[model samples]
Target: MQGIIHLWSLDATEPHELTTETLGQAQILGCGSVLHLLRTLSWVRTKQNRIAESSTKLWLVSRNAVGLERMQAQSPDSSRQDSSTRDSLAIAQAPLWGLGKVIALEHAELWGGMIDNPEVADVLVEIGAAIVSGEKEDQVAYRDGQRYVARLVKSDPLAFDGTSLSTENSYLITGGLGTLGLKVARWMIDQGVRYLVLTGRGVPSIEAQRRLDQLEEAGATIMVANADVSDGARMTRLFQEIEEKMPSLRGVIHAAGVLDKEILTKQDWGRFRRAIAAKVEGSWHLHTLTRAMPLDFFVCFSSTASLLGGLRLGSDAAAFMDTLAHLRHFMGLPGSSIDWTMWADDGMSLPSQEDGKFEDNDWGGSDKLAEYTMAPGIGLRILGTLMRKADTAADAVQVVVLPKDLSYLQGFYGDRIPPPLLSELYRSESVQPSGSSDFMEELEKIPVEKKRDHLATHIQSQLNRVLGFAPSQTMDLQKGFFDLGMDSLMAVEIKNRLQTSLGCKLPTTLAFKYSTPSLLIDYIATQILALESPEGIVTESKRAANEPEEILNKVKRLSEEDLEALIDEKVRF
Candidate 1:
């Protein structure tokens, strides 16, 4: 079979057959099962060679995993502009969608697709047709018995007439001492907001204090509360203080989050919990505390990692905020979640040079696709747009806000083509260049003595592109990759670039094992020599002797199913 479908259910005892009624409204839950399944799938891909073959596709099915506009039968003379276009969102499954995006990027060959069913209609038939249709649309959601595909369309900031912040009402901003918080505070002041309550885990730094003072000087009454949003007692106390001293809470901006970056193999529960502490738990506290209040708007600042997974950003956990926003809207509350790309001035999200300014290159070579970093001015304008639309557009609670053209992001994927989800935003129809064959032919034309040098130069050029080094600058062949400030994402990029160029199946931990350019050169040279060997005789002998550790690594990375498969094969033999 070309495809294998795996169905995930909350109640495992339930039969695998489809049902007529919807399962239930989406909820905000933990990620224990989600993480387990992701870990298993990751291992399966790494260990099972057949599963990773180009012809085989792996599909994951989830219920109520995505939030989409519910379809209504169009009337002849009436327009459908109802506020209840969405029923509920499965916030608990946000991690699956977030991580799935990353998987689609990292393993496009084995990726079948992600299908979210509402369970209200012929779920089996819809899923079967989706898989067999040979379409590039990987992210699909069914709502009200209608099929809907996700799209990342461009929205103009000017299209939204900005909302006015009342001078008499108080607004609470979590993580208010950080860069984004202060920027929003400044914007609020500009919008004529007079009362502001800003909360953070600790006392503000000198810079934060300076910004706070600036806001106070602008004729706004500001309250700086040292409280962690994740702590229920602390959040309650802060709300009490606001009740006693400040004006009635009119709005809330949930901007609290912590960044945790690691691959699945390296991730632990502690890291995952830290990543979701402020994003999920803190948002929950805010939701429960303010559910009774008649707020004008409730905004949550989410990352693009939730929508389009970032490399090693723990995007799965980060996606909970999106679901939380949807949950609020489902309850008829004024809620909106803004999935923001990296901010130009936000140091917490983007790595910067010692001078505090971004490098001349795009995103300092960490992410070539981040040319659309949201500037403070533009981001706040989008926030204003969201605030204005929160009441009228309840179904638009989850908004993926990115400015300008997004076609260049296609380069970020392994296929060098934008996923169907981004078709509306990315209109690039350029032909994909096939360079691996030409590269191999050039390698064959090179003399045997100069092959190593040629490969070295090519590897160095790719490394230079990743590291943002000038083309003329030479990287030390003996120096370690990590020592040159290369991160895990950079390592993955280098490995992917080489794998694509060389047309070889390199290990996922390629840079980690090789460590240095000189060492990597030797290993790659051997692979090239083996590929060019006569009758595949030298390839077999050299592979066994020179790459025993690779075999051992594969064995070490085996999953439970892999071990079971091995036992079955041994019994058959």
Candidate 2:
């Protein structure tokens, strides 16, 4: 505590002895500052020859750096407070939390944690105690002397409780020519939105135009307007045009965004501005333009990058975080910012699984450690469900879809115990064991000739699950994985499933290489049987002819009630 170096006052020229602790305050400067500060600290430590061995921890303190649940509503003087003004100020600091998460992942040793003071109440003493006691929470906030931590909880699907989209009214979708925008457009039409205004900066692509024609043929009115949402004058004119030609605008989906991938050191202000313009400035224009309209929902499509930071995504994090603040604080309408994970199984282009599939760089240089990416069908269902719960959007402003597996997270965090934010997810995955090892053991007991059939059955079951097919449905064994509607992400998922069950290092191109169920089963069975003997022979003791009945009898001993639960637990048919 004696030599605590304050980040603001630290003299870089005259090097002081590195201490065990350092304190810094987060500024409203662009998210690049996060990288800048950490880089500077690391440089200083390296110069002192203590970068690798030092136990020094850097803690960042900020006022309203992140939003705490009910922090404002729970305040004593909430009624008189100007919530919008406070939230706008909070928006500037929101990027710190997003970028700070990346710093934690990339520079874990030097990272202490981030603390947000949401209220005027002094928590300096509490902050010191938390740091001095080696508190594990990396993201914490204080309000009215009460401490709060960020947590990710499983979101059970909410029932549709609001009115359906009116066919007579108009819905506006920004960035409507893009993949996500077009997907949402189709979903809106499915929900009975007959009149839609789809706006984008450039003319639609051939595929985009084809989809537009399909929507038009389906008894819906489609207006494809070429206008940049970030341009204030253009946006105003677009709104005027919409009002003049279409039905009254009742809903808006601000899916407009620009993604530029670069590390912070290589990032320029122009790149940051271009990325932020579509999401931040564009959303602001939409809010100001339609603040008084009777809009049912104003949904901002955000990425998981903002909630759980990614490498080379600092600008995206800043843009999405600011947009979230704009929706929650600035927009009084029914607005929600859903931070969605990678959308797969649609037409989104991904790295080829043919070679170097599991390499870190293969994932577009992203730190997205996810078990399951969102499929368009599932994502659209979630979006539809959220539309009905518009009233709760203000309270639960940010809805982030978390990774399903803790083990995938371990690959990034490099620890058995996850950080505080992911602790809940870790505990959930821990309690509900996947039972993959048990399946493998059962698989090894099968006769060599029958192992191929069993493996095929297992692979079929997984394919069914991924494609959302009924358990009884069977896919063509001769068709390729992609031909059977499997995308790149789905291929990765199948590979992970196989590796876990077989307990071997399967290639990332497992699905693609095998290409079909028949080939896939043959390869997997050969690999497993080869481990037993060169001739692919299993021990007679392990392969009993009555193995199936033995398993049935083992199950029959349980009560009928317990038998039903067993069936529910088994993922295989």
lDDT of 1 by residue, 452-562 (tens): 677788888888777667545687889877665454556666876786788766664566557788888877877544533233445666676878789788888999899
lDDT of 2 by residue, 100-152 (tens): 66555545556667666634333354345545885677677665555667776
State TM-scores per candidate.
0.74, 0.61
Superposed by TM-score, candidate 1 places the C-alpha of residue 226 at a distance from the truth, in angstroms, of 2.9
lDDT for 408 in candidate 2 is: 53
Which parts of model 2 have CA positions greater than 4 angstroms off? 1-32, 42-58, 70-89, 118-131, 161-163, 311-332, 347-370, 392-396, 403-406, 427-573
